[model samples]
Target chain A: MKTRQRILHYTGEVVLILFLVIFLIPLIQTFFTALKPDIEIYKTPVHIFPQHFSNVHYLHVFTRLSKDFISFFKNSVVITTVSVFLILGLGSLAAFSLARIDFVGKGFIIFFISLILSIPLIITVIPIFMMETAMGIKNSNLGLILPYTAVYLPIPLFIIYNNFLKVPTELEESAYMDGANRLQIFTKIFLPLIQGGLIAAAIITFLNCWGEFLFALILNTKRSATTLPIGIMMINDEEQSWALGPMSAVMILSIILPMSLYMIFQKNFVKGLMEGSVKG
Target chain B: MKSLKQGKKIRDNIVGWLFVLPAFVFLFSFMIYPISRTFILSFQKFNFVYDSKPVFVGLSNYVEALKTPSYLTALKNTLRFTLWYIPVIIVLGFLFGYIITLPKLFSSKLAKIVLFVPMVIPISMSCYMFLFILNPQWGLVNSFLANTIHLPMLVRDWMNDPRYALKIIIVVTVWQRIGFISLLFMSGIQGISSSIMEAAIIDGASAARRMWSIVLPNLKETFQIVGILAIITSIKLFAQVVAMTGALGPNSAGGPANSTLTLYVATWKAAFINFDMGVGSAMGYLMSLIIFLLFGLNFMLTKSERA
Candidate 1:
């Protein structure tokens, strides 16, 4: 019985390790390929490790695609930042009202917002394209920011609303007794209590806007306004045909921001996902 | 006194309105308006370029969309993709969930972090990474299989071939998504009372029997959530197809022989590439109808279970 138990434990460890390796192979391969020179990319029997490492690909991306690359990065940063802030500010306020305040038409409104969340972005892209173009913000960063904030509003709103509900109403009533106005109570008491939900909402919104491609692809056709994902897609199309090295480098660069963001806030992000799923 | 009371009531309503006004404004403009416009456009022959009057054609667009071969193929491919995606992801997810939960694994948390790393990277990056690794010539996957394993039979051009194109996309999608599914399952597993497991063990039930009779049944909610979410995400699949194929595949959207064209991609081509807004709007409505039905079904199931 002891031998059987030991065998099972060892076998499980081996299987887990093997699975991990298989899971990470693409990322590992890309890192190696990103370090190789253009000529070595197509070398026979694929050198998993490059014989001679090259920083030339990274240099080329920074130098040659510098304008497009920087613009893409800047656009992604500004759009994601603005969208996240808007969603949080508006979502929290709305959630405070929905969860705490007595109001008419609240049930219908919440149901409507949930419906908005359910609709696919693809369905909304065309009309948004037309509306933004008509309003003359289509090619601007604000164009993408507006739609992203709206589309991602429901999730954060839902999360924060639940967060507010979990906060004790007695606390708010006591704050009122202490002469704290509604705004003061909201900012001082409720916001502090729901900081976890706020962080989760912020991270999810930022990531969603950061990774957003379809809207950015369709709405922002100008090279200067394109976000990182769109830039990666465009560069991949143009460079993959003749130059795989630079493309790999840009791809690697594009992945760093989101990866670090996730790593830094891994716990909150996972908490957000779990909470969102439970609501679903 | 009556006027004072009415005024106070009105003030309360105003305060409530002020709180929710900002989010509602954005939601109304972007979400509600676009959806209504799309519905309206579905009934008209509105092209952004050549149309002058925005002529109303009344269901012809829907008929045309249904008749189009690409749209039909996309619909079929979506169903096919979902069919292959849901079951594989659920089973693999539960397996990983079980593995990491093992007490003997010293670094289970580290293993989980590694599994979830891919989730942070955008689909575009992951898809392109797979494209490089899965390249037929000089690709890591082919090289490993052909040389190290000495099994050339298993090596083939995965993304370009008609038979394997959709399957390959499914593989990458599942790979990126498995971590989330596993996490969901892990949460579900943690919800299970350990006392129940101890009771089963004391009753001398084998590990496999305990899992089959106790664990699997207890995970019914996780299975439902994972399945529904997987189906919904798969239905919206676009970035992976575009990045993986570079829009150079057959039909300029899906992979070779149009084997990977999904409804989302098809709608994109219609609206942007062909400038056929009417057809695109029609397809979007049809797709949403299907998704709505799925949500309805899921709601019914959950409600019934609760009852």
Candidate 2:
């Protein structure tokens, strides 16, 4: 029986390793293709490994292919940063109230947030586009920022609210006994305890804002405000589509921040997602 | 003394509303207002191309969408995609979830991270990578088939081929999402009581029997959640189709005979490309209605099961 258990364990390990390798093939291929010389990229029976590696694609992507690439990257950074900040601030405040404070209509507010969560973005984008146009906010960073904050708020709110529930009520009571107001208690006591939750919420919000394509595409048609994903899509224009190496280079560049965030704060990301999923 | 207590309760109510006010304002402006506006727009005749003012048209847009072949095809394709996508994700999610949680697997952490890598990367970037890997002339699949395996006859342009385009889009989306779904399942499996599992093991149940009798039954709520999420996501399939098929141009998103056209893509094309706001809003409204019904139905079924 011991031997049989050992055999089962070994088999599970082998299957897992094999699946991991197969799963990473696309990502590996993207990296390899990005490094290969342009001529090799066009060669038949595409090489999985670059015979002669080159940095030309990276250079071209940053310098020649898309002159506005830096601006796009900057837009992505600024927009994602600002959106995450707003989401965390507003989400935590609301979450704190819902979780701790007893008020009339509290249950209705929770129900309303969940209901809004169910409304998919595709249904809402057209009117948003029109509204942005009418208000002359189209082709600006604020246009995407406002909608993104609204759309992505529910998940973080719930995650933070759950986090708030886990904090001991004694902390709040003690703070109140010390003559601390509600605001002071929130900032001084509860906030420190829920740091992990805040990080989780922040990471999820950052990833969503960074990767959002549709809103960025429709709202920011101008080069001045286009984010990374839309900028990458723009590389598919008639002239640049054939430049596979440069395109792959651009793809790699776009994913670096998200990949690193996932690598470092993986546990927080998983926690946030699992919490949201169970509630969902 | 009672009046002071009452005053404190009123203050608490005021504070609670103040805290929620900012988020409420944003949700109201972006979500509630836009949704109502779309509903109203669906019933009007507004075409940007004609430079015409909005005119109230009663249900004509919805009637025309039902009659339109392309819109109908888009709806059919979305349903078909959802039918194919949900089961594959569920089965694979369970398999991977179970495997990664196996005892003494030192590589479980590595496996989980690798599996979840795709979820963090943007969907459009992944779709573009698949686009390159499936290119007919120099793509990995065709090249490997033709030159390495000598199966040249089997090679074809995948994304542009009507017979295979939708299937390719499904494959790409599944690849992007499988990791996320698997991780969700993994958490569900982990949430199962260890004592129960140990008891089954002591009872001499084989691995397959343990999984079938114990794990599967315990994962009911997880299944419901995953199913609802999968259905909603599949219905909102826009990015994959757009990024994969729109390589030529934005207008070609649902191309090669529109075999891959989804409701979202069709709505996008109608409003943005054809400048037909009424038709697009109508399609969007219908799609949302379907989504809400499915979501509500899933909840009802789960509630009944619990009872």
Candidate of highest lDDT:
2
**Winning candidate number (TM-score):** 2
Model 1 RMSD vs true structure: 2.3
Lowest lDDT 10-mer window, candidate 1 chain B? Answer: B246-255
The lowest-lDDT stretch of 10 consecutive residues in candidate 1 chain A is A235-244
Chain A accuracy of model 1 expressed as TM-score: 0.94
User: How well does candidate 2 match the true structure in TM-score terms?
Assistant: 0.96
> All candidates: CA RMSD in angstroms?
2.3, 1.8
Best by DockQ: 2
TM-score per candidate for chain A alone: 0.94, 0.94
The DockQ of each candidate is: 0.68, 0.73
TM per candidate comes to 0.95, 0.96
Error of 2 at B288 (Å): 0.9
